[model samples]
Target: MPSGPSFLKKFTSLILSFGPGIFAIGYTIGTGSVTSMIVAGSTHGMQLLWVLLLSCLFSGILIYVYGNYTLLTGETALFAFKRHLKWGRVMAILIIIGIAIGQWNSLMGIMGISSNIIYEIFAIYFPGISSFKYEAVITIALVLTAVFYALLLVGRYTFFEKILVVFVTIMGVSFLISLFMVYPLPEDVIKGLVPSIPQVKGGRMLVAAFVGTTMAAATFLSRPLFVKGKGWTINNLKEQKKDAIVAAILVFVISGAIMAVATGALFYEGKPVTQVLDMVNTLEPVAGKFALTLFFFGTLSAGLSSIFPILLIVPILIADYQSGQLDTNSKQFKRITAFACLFALIVPIFGSNPVEMQILSQIFNVFVLPLVILGILLLINKKSIVQVHKTHFLLNIGLGLALLFACIISYNGVKALIDYF
Candidate 1:
């Protein structure tokens, strides 16, 4: 029995403590993840599930390490890179360019897929709408983009966190329910958890894409920003670690559920899924209309959740490079964010194949992983920057292995991109 003011204070503290991690989950489990997981399961069944698990596992480690670095140094990733090591500025520039291109491609795909799904839903419910017009689709995409930017423009970090929590809840619960409707076999899931790559053609490329997208370089780079925004420090390291673990677990569970639903509903069927709409059509017969609708909205929410962060990432990167504060109220910040959000419109307005663009963005994402990993490894181990929080030998070893894995994936990603072009 505490006083009202005291109880409210406690509650606010609790919410703030978990806010960064929840934001991470919201940012991580977006359209790219939903698309990747569903495609993997639909095309290859649960054979690649281990890749999701391992990617999340590695992502969790790297995320924690990066957060820890920021807590100890009071510096964001780009600043740390700039201040600590030689060639850091060049690496930062490369990272910014890579992430900008990848995010631009993803922004187009997200808006395109979300608008398409909405248009289809409208056509289904409203018989008067005879055809799915590109005009309507583009209009919806523009509206969605405007709404996302408006929210970011007005909202602070707390508000953004609350919105993400709502989105993550809606998307997570909907996907989980849909998964239950067509529950995958436990034995198949168990087999999927075992560490083994499929022998199928393009399996290596698929694995690389999965790893690249899940353990994305942007996610790691963004971690420090979130941590610093939350005002976390060495004293809050334990809480930061807990937050990272929770975010990682959420990524695994939500991603696994998406794959499970796809595996149970689409695998072994002769049908091929080329887009999100194809998923809905295939799932309608197997999981019924209710589940299909849930999945559709769930996917839409995922797309929207992802857009929020993509809008802010460029601004954050710029802020970090300039050694400036992450003040949403600043004119420069708003301008950069608005431009990034609006720039996505070009693809939907002009691109012929949104799905191909999305896939290409994911491949581009793979090329950046090794660079980010190497940067973090070099910075974190340096006693000059990290101080007493210098990475322990075991953690360094783990990161070293991750760097090696990222390098291999980068090679495969490059080869895949060449093949695609």
Candidate 2:
């Protein structure tokens, strides 16, 4: 470690250039994703690592494709859809509505989980705050909502990205520490790469949630917006691809670490994670109190990072729908984000199980995946619009595989929901 200011300087330099992808990771790998990974890892050990593997793979491809579109055509994803394809206006509207609903549902989970984690941390330290559980949780969630809303009102796009960089760095370090302290067996991890679904209840939904949260439609759709905000062009294609790769790799490593930690510390003991408290305890014995504190901080950082972006997503998507230019200081942006932050309070205040709510919210994103992937597939292949920059054969094949994967998972998501009901 470099001393004092030099260490801070190098760290800031390291992450500043990785803006867009870091923002995406900041949004995707949050409390919802963490909770889902913990539940799956605790219940089924490393069996579902394949789901995480493929999700990160496809996530990189989709992010590259979406970012590439803005690079080539200088158009955001929704605007490209509306401008090129027929019935695209309606399609864009549905996307706006669908993604908005799913992301809002996600906000509830993020807020609830973060608040509850704070509650857990308090209960662990003081041991008496257990009686004020709901009161403490609601207060934390409300304060967080207000703080994020205030940040939205005052800060620009780059400001939000900078803040997320801090969150990502902290969570990354925290989880890595926990993983090192309580890593799973090499044989079990290797077996996880072979791909076998669990026959137990909620297994299918966990699969869908893993895919949905990692390979999120919101991630791809919003890539163009973030790319444009970064002010990249065709000249920056390589840089954009590198950023996407970084995002995908971080998603995999951080998420996998959390899962592996759970497998090592919880699964062997025959414990199942149904709540945030279960997650906190997953690091017990081997890692002890300090590790548990770090883990909760990671969860808390993940939640805050996600909540900020989730609050802004509605305005960002709507901005793309109306015009590619995002006026962050505009009334539409402030009003939409304000309402979203307010809406996020409901879950923490009255919700029973944030973990279940989070997994359900993540699974919901899968239902929108097929259409999202198909729309991009059609757009990238359209010669009239793409001209010389048309998608190549290999990428097209990858997109095709992605489409198939999306459809299969979408079906699973639906069936799982039906069974759940």
Candidate 3:
């Protein structure tokens, strides 16, 4: 029906339209995946391999549903929930606040993790200047934040789109490099493919940690912003689905490679890695320090890229709630951004265990996921939206299962917190 070049151009345009979901994948697969993979390897030696696979599958489905819901409603998840579910606005507001706090906490955790990895590699190469580590982290953070702000301030959707594409490219390449260089044993690694729970000496705590790492509740909730950013409408369901499929598959692949690397390198050494930096050090022998440096850079890119959008969303949520308006270029936007920046800076000042904060926020996130999914499912199925695109029975069942799993993890995490206190 069309000429070859014309058809190819249209196809490329269609693919480009799927930008938002791919970008959302960046947020989830960042420091979150790093922590999760490290936990899987260092603690149980791939005993929780099934968790990674299962969570990715479930997360992919959730992302697709959220994207589709946004497209059908022509509104972001927060706006849709607020406008249509006015009675539940208070609860929705609370959940949004929780997500915002979670984002801030996550940004800090990512920074700490990235800096530690960078510092470790620097120590290996330079071999003398331990004094430079803190200064290096500060310098890196400032530069990164400035770059993120500049890109957003430019107010060009195309720039955001290109940044996301480049990051995804880097992520894919960096992972492949690590995977190849690590040279993992094929048979033992293949054994990890079979799903089975590990017998951790500390038992339930380890299991809960595994769940926290794999599930990544806030990452799931963050999908709506990226989906909305693409400006897709109800007419774009098919293209959106394709985007979700590609992005989800990419997440599974990248995260799986990370777990494999950790398992091959650390599990064999019988190393203990309570934090992400430990994971970096564990890889030193197998992939060498250079490869580890690449890994840290990759981790930094993942974390830093997420900072702008995450910081932006918190203010956006707060402003939209109080004023019943959505203005990107308002005083409210600037105020919210300041608050996010303050939150980002203040967490490190508290001198708390950054890793523990990440774990705690993740647990809190699990408690929030079921409610968010419930809101998404309910809002998407409304007649005013695309009543025809209402969630099918199987989709309902999957969301129900995700909710059920979230509840289980929440109960476990709360118990762990109680024990900690």
Candidate 4:
């Protein structure tokens, strides 16, 4: 048997090996997933939990595939697309544009919601703030944005991963505890595990949002980048698969816990949750102050965790597009990150409807899914690029089914947007 110190070293190495997956968990399970899951459970009950499971499973497969492709080719997703296939450059540009728009919208929404939650917490303690004001909320959001930017700008990739692991852990634990407090009915929860759609209005849209957020384009785009950033190679394929599994499981647990809490505390009582903050009021009456506070902290952590990756994505995408190394210290990288973070402020500062913006961002993400899936399919099958690492028969089938799933969700997402407009 190993000595205590040796055991500790091994444990530390194992945890460190999980960096890419931990980063993925942090990137996902953010405001978008939290909001979507809560809305689904609060309004539609546990009927949509199966969608979350399906999405996470699909996302896991894609994450592994992307990471494996990067390891084999030493190319990030964008560079692979741009340099490998026909019309690859055009596809890369479209992906960059689509992801940029979706991420920017999400960043604004996350900041807005996080600020409101913080302000509400402050009001509870002080009992002196008479009314909530937009200006005050915006100011809080700017501060949060500044803090997020500083953390990303000053930290190296490992620092970023370590911080995110901490945030994701806090958020995951908080939500898990909150879920236990609710104690959802076993049968209802089990029913959610069985695949069946609810007959509620906007049910399809909710399904789309759940899938979109869980299997987001940004998640896939960032997976290879994380793999490459961690200096993973073809020899790390097994580790990459393990990491993907960990991330997928984390996504399901965190998302499922939030949904269960919402279902048991709100849906069982027939309460409607139209906005993210609406849960604060509803959860308090159902699960008490402690649960409410825990939920808020979880959401705040999620928002911060999400914003870190959202800010890095644009810079990373630009680097991939230019076939350049991702140098965090580079002036271009810092400038791009800053500009993206600052530009997102426009929504929270000037827009009157942040909840709508958040929902729209998720819906827009679905529209981008089919294109990304198609690109991944095309790139992974290219014999010249993937070579011996080319996808096998079963893997291709899985990718095909995932592509089909993306197409169906994309169609529903578009229909929902049109109906709303």
Candidate 5:
């Protein structure tokens, strides 16, 4: 073992090497994290806080499992699926479709919510700036879209990873600062740690919704793809572990802080938070209107930063299903990116209910959760790839539990949708 100073020097370099997973965590903690946590804080007032805690633990385990496999095998999860079990290719395709639907809903919803937040910020700041609201949103979106394409053109993983890390750090600090300013009660916060149901009639559904949002199907599917993009290998095992742990902790902090802020401002006041804008507005009385503006900017950054990688992941996933691996330079990758962007542009134009759309898309996305997880687990644990590093029995059992929980959620989700229809 190295001495303390030497270890610190090496550790710093290892941390720098672990970028893609950090960005993948950013993608996971975007709209889903914001919307669901906002809903939980307003509706249940931290009573369902255990959902985030439990989901974070489970999500960490899943990310570690997926990231470890990619690091060991040097192949993305989709390719592993095709190579190990040819018949399981359909499940891989389903994972991509599920991811595409989820990403489509999230990308559009984030844009809409962030746009609303910006509009509110201008109104609060300038107070008379009515005309620029729409233009401002369009301008911001175009700027972000252009930056995304520019990064894609460069085609270097390091550049994309650095941009994502910078954005993630900024967004994370902004929210943490907001939470500190709010100064929530420690006793009530502690009470949130207990796993109790809320008092409302529809509280259980909200609890499940909270769980669904945190343990998002798309977030799960995207982990391996993101790891592959980083070009990790067996030589980087230490780096992979560090990256997974850091990424998971970062996600938990940002998501949990958002919940804390919402609960601090709205929960005790008996206010409702049905939309992201509502959460932003609720912050004004407690943290001042300018704080709300800051929150909006932070939220906007969080949402906008995630759109590119999510788009990038989809086409690569689709391409991997057709071929055993993804060629970033291939026509399929470009076409899929275009298709994803088209969906992003069109999804919100229909003017559907954002919450309802989130619920529907998540429901459809959850259907393939079992298949996707199973295939990934199987491929990763295979002798050819894993060799002596096969998955442990305990890990397999835990994965089984995750799959079971996902299936139960999917069943309830489908039943709810069917009854509604």
Candidate 6:
């Protein structure tokens, strides 16, 4: 066997190649996702695991499909939609509007929840901070937004990717530690693989939400841009596939860890998770201070990791709308990031319901998913564009299945939203 240094070098090289995928994990598992997975676990045990599994499965396929398109053609998703297909302009505009709205709304909840987490952390060590909840959260939100925007101005795509890798690593390691500390039964987790939903009143909606959160339009749509930003091309096809696989697996593992922790710590005890502190306190009774702190760290990492990408979404998409070249130094990029930071302030300032914002964001996300898939379906299959690199029959079948899944989830998500209101 090679010496320790050589093995370490190979491992480091492998991890570095997955920059875009790691970026996806950080982007996908924001505070909203944490709450959803925890609530799913606490309420239904591992019964909803099927939803997460299938979502991640299709998520990988779509990532590969979308990234493959860019690798083959050297064009971003939105530009291809607007430039190539019939009625392409309308479709591109609609996607832009849809994803932008969903993402900004999600940003509000992330900033709000993340701010509350910071406040909660303070409150734990110093009880006096609890009385000034609004003031505390607001100040933290301001500082976080400012720090993130500063980092935005100072760095380019690789810089952002490197930062997310840190957060993702922290998040994954924290959650894995907490999971090993307290775990659900293997039989329960095994049962989740069989695919069934809880028969509760809003069970269908929760399942739809599981899909919405995991199989995000943003995750797939943005992959091409990230891949191109990594300076990858068709020659990097093997690496791209490996990256997508790693990312999808990470999503499943991290999300599954959250679910398992909730199941072991909260489900058996019948504890509720309506707030950030709920899960924290639940873990406290099960595994003491260390596990609780780890959970908090995981959550903070998830939130901070998400904030960077959420701020970049508008600028990135607008850049993709023109083509795939993202100039962080451009005035347009600066103005958009500044604008998104303002939106992030709303929830912390006025105090909106995080759960409500989360639900609404998923509704918008699920509704746009079908269109997102169909557009790519057209482009990936076009012989004029993809040449000999056209999608295979199996991949087209997978896309068809993804489209059908998207439509189903959209219907359930809308129904859930109506019921919620």
User: If scored against the real structure, what TM-score would every candidate get?
Assistant: 0.93, 0.97, 0.84, 0.93, 0.86, 0.95
* lDDT of every model, 2 decimals: 0.81, 0.87, 0.65, 0.82, 0.67, 0.84
Off by over 4 Å in 5: 1-17, 125-128, 131-143, 196-205, 324-326, 347-363, 419-421
Descending-TM-score candidate ranking: 2, 6, 4, 1, 5, 3
Cα lDDT tens digits for candidate 4, 1-421 = 6599899799667666676888778777888788887888888888887888889888888888888888888888888788877888898898889888888888888777777777787777876663656666778888887888888778488888888877887898899999889957888888888987666677767777788788888888888878877887888888888888888988998999999988989999998788756877788998998998898899889888888888888888888788735557678888888898787687668844656677778887887788788898898887887777658888788889999999988888888777777
Better of 4 and 6 by TM-score: 6
Clash pairs of candidate 1? none
* Tens digits of per-residue lDDT for model 2, 184-285: 899999999998889988989999999989988899988998888887889999999999999999999999999998898888888889977777655666
Write one digit per residue (lDDT tens) for candidate 1, span 291-315: 9999888998898888888888877
Give the least accurate 10-residue stretch of model 6, judged by summed lDDT.
Answer: 354-363
What C-alpha lDDT does candidate 4 achieve relative to the native structure?
A: 0.82
Candidate 6 residue lDDT tens string, 179-247: 998789999999988878777767777777688778888888788888988899889998898888988
By TM-score, who's the top model here?
A: 2
lDDT of 5: 0.67
Best candidate, lDDT:
2
Across 317-386, the per-residue lDDT of candidate 5 in tens digits comes to: 7766666454466677767666666566543445444544544444455566677667766776678778
lDDT of 2 at 260: 91
lDDT of 2 at 381: 91
lDDT, residue 119, model 3: 61
- Model 6, position 176: C-alpha lDDT score: 93
lDDT string for model 3 (1-421, tens) is 5699899799667556556765656666767556756666665666666666666677777878877766665566666667788555865677776777666777777656655555666677887767765666665555555556666566554566677666766766777687777644777666766866555444445456555545555554545555555566767788778877777787877777777767767777888567655665577777787778666666666666556556666665655455433345666676666656656654344444556556555555565666776776677567777667656888888888877776776787677667666
Candidate with better TM-score, 2 vs 4: 2
Among all windows of ten consecutive residues in candidate 1, which has the lowest summed lDDT? 351-360
